[model samples]
Target chain A: MAKKLALIASKGTLDWAYPPFILASTAAALDYEVCIFFTFYGLTLLKKDISDLKVSPLGNPAMPMPVPMPNFVQMLPGMESMATMMMKQQIADKGVASIEDLRRACLESGVKLIACQMTVDLFDFKRSDFIEGIEIGGAATFFEFAGNSDVSLFI
Target chain B: MDFDKEVDAKNLNCPLPILRCKKGLNDLQANQVLKIMATDPGSVKDFEAFCKQTGHTLLQLDQTDKVFTFYIKKRNDAL
Candidate 1:
């Protein structure tokens, strides 16, 4: 039997979104069965409109910049959008896979994408909001797979 | 020095190189080699781990300039 991997993806920022799908796709490529549980804000990754995911640099002193700026400067009204644009530019220049690309790879490779049902209800999201081919499930369903996983991570 | 196919993973970041390599290997016959050229520095170690885990053989690892080249031979009876 193939090794199983379970991942909980709980963040939605552009920067935070890459890890789970990246790991899951790679694991699937490596012949491991992989599943990612998208809960809380992470569910945004599965939304039909993923083009608007943004990264915030506010209070993130470690975020690399052409010139390091103070938190006050990062807190400026337009700074978040600026940071998101910069990050998008960097990603394109570096040939990094966009989150959507990685997520598609995961799905194509048969990685199970599970949206947290409770969170879906809590957030007042419609099932129609997500892309095709995702399951809606809660913690018990997650534990069913996570229990036997050879590798489990909360990303 | 010879490979049945080549995957141009050049400039692609993590998982892409490996993902492309996997797709390339999938199209090859057993023991046929797949060569991958990548510009991402991380692909060096990533390919190593990929080959190790997938039962593919890493025949050669070479570098010239910024490119990292990998030659992988697909496993017999590979899934």
Candidate 2:
């Protein structure tokens, strides 16, 4: 039997979004069966329209800037979008795959995409609002899968 | 210096190089060697972990400047 990996994606920021997707795709390539459970803000990534996925620079000490900016400046209106744009540009410049590309790669590699049913209900998301091939489930379902996984991570 | 196949993963970062190497190795016969050239600095550890996890043979690893070259042999039991 193939090795199993279970991952939880709980954050929606661009930087936060990459770990589960990257790990899942890589684990699939390594012949491990990977399942990613998207909950809370992470459900936004599965939405058909991902334009709202912004990087929160405010209070995010890890957010790298071309020029150092104070926390107060990051709290200014529009700063989050500016930081998001900068991050996107940096990712593009580095030839890294975009979230869309990574998502497609994960699917191609047979990684299972699961969305939190509770979050979907809480956020008023319709099944049709997300990309195809997503399985909707609650924590119980996630625990069942994770129980058999060789590796489980909460990212 | 002999390899049955070569995968150029230059400029690809993180898991991309390892993913490409995994896919490339799938095409080779048992014991056939594959050479992967990558520019990502993290690929050294990534490939090591990949080989360890997948049960492939890491024949040799060499680095010249920024490029990392890994020679791997496919294991027959790898499916």
Task: Write one digit per residue (lDDT tens) for candidate 1, span B1-79.
Answer: 9999998999898879999998899899999999999999988988889888888899999999999999999999887
Point out the worst 10-residue segment of candidate 1 chain B by lDDT: B46-55
| Candidate 2 deviant stretches above 4 angstroms | none
Q: Identify the candidate with maximal TM-score.
A: 1
Q: Supply DockQ values for each candidate.
A: 0.89, 0.66
Query: Model 1 segments beyond 4 Å from truth?
Result: none
So what's the TM-score on candidate 2? 0.91
Candidate 2: clashing pairs of residues: none
- Per-residue alpha-carbon lDDT of model 2 for A114-147, expressed as tens digits? 9999999999999998999889999999988899
Residue A78 lDDT in candidate 1:
90
lDDT of each: 0.93, 0.89
